[model samples]
Target: MLVAAAVCPCPPLLVPAVAAGAASELADARTACSDALAVLAASRPDRLVVIGPAEEGARGVHPAGAAGSFAGFGVDLTVRLGSGPGGERALPASLAVGAWLLDHTDWADAPIEGLGVGTELQPARCAEAGREIGASAERVALLVMGDGSACRTVKAPGYLDERAEGFDAAVGHALGTADPAALLALDPELAQALQAAGRAPWQVLAGAAEGTGLEGRLLYEDAPYGVGYFVAAWS
Candidate 1:
């Protein structure tokens, strides 16, 4: 069962080196992420699983100590999921960002692993994956990483979409309230249309927390660089 969970945005920009001169723009979100990690530490979980959206090549399990680098983003920084045996597969960008967050927070409370869900994965599969993760240990914690709508502004990655605001609002509410049903109810078609990368992973979180009865708090919510970023903690 899930003892605690933290929802965070997966933008590489969250890393100061990746963001370069623009790093300060995400200072508040970074602080909130640190606080959320503290909540996970307090839970004293037996295992920690990081979930994030990934491309086809990066989808699937990434073991603890799996290596990932920001070189693809023009940075030479490298990160590991946690201290453990290394794996052959590299961490996806989303999971890499998750790893970066773990490192930044100095997480050492439990064994760490990662799962990279494909963006096109169906809700049912995502939920099943989550259920498996929740059952993997006695007390499980999750660090979910993904972004909301990228169509908040005309200059956004997906360009302006009239439905973006409403979509993000509902997502914020669901995450803030720990409403699994609400998260599961999100329209995949609509989410894809709005380029909401968080849809699949958030649904996975919903599945994992099905009967955990965790309470939630919204740590932060914002649209920076035309992308919706959110941080929430459940424990």
Candidate 2:
């Protein structure tokens, strides 16, 4: 069962080096993420699983010490999920961001692992995957990484979509309240249309938290660079 969970955006921009001169733009998000991670540490979980959306080839399990690089984003930084023997396979971008966050927090409370879910993964499969994770350890903690709508403005990666704001709002509310049913109820097709990458990962979190009685607090919600980024903590 999940002892705690932290939800955060997966944008590479969260890394100061990746963001370069604009790093300050995400200062609040970074602080919120820090606080969320603190919550995870406080739970004293036996295991930590980092879940994030990924491309087809990147989907699957990433072991502790799995390597991730920001070099692709023009940064020389490299991160590991946690200290252990490294893996041959590279982590997906989303998991890489998750790894970066873990490194930033110097997380040492539990053994860490990562799962990269495809953006198009069905809700059922996502939930099933989450259930498996929840059962993997006596006290599990999750660091979920993915972005909300990417079309809040014309400058957004997917460009402006009229439905973006409403979609993000609903997601924010659901996360803030730790409403698994509401998260599971998100329309996949609509989410895809709005370019909401968080849909699948958030649903996975919902599945893992079932019967855990966790309550959530929304730490941050914003549309920066036209993409919705959120940070929430459940405990």
Every model's TM-score: 0.98, 0.98
Compose the digit string of candidate 1's lDDT tens values, residues 1-235.
Answer: 9989999999999999999999999999999999998888888889999999998878888888999999999999999998889699899999999898888785666999998887778888888888888998999999999899999999999999999999999999999999988998889999989989999999999999999899999999999989999999999
> Residue-wise lDDT of candidate 2 within 1-235, one digit each (tens)?
8999999999999999999999999999999999999999888999999999988777888888999999999999898999888678899999999988888885665899999888888999888888888998899999999899999999999999999999999999999999988999999999999889999999999999988889999999999999999999999
lDDT per model vs. reference: 0.92, 0.92
For candidate 1, the lDDT comes to 0.92
Instruction: Report the lDDT of model 2 for residue 23.
Output: 98
lDDT for position 21 in model 2: 100
Candidate 2, backbone clash total: 0
Model 2 pairs whose backbones collide: none
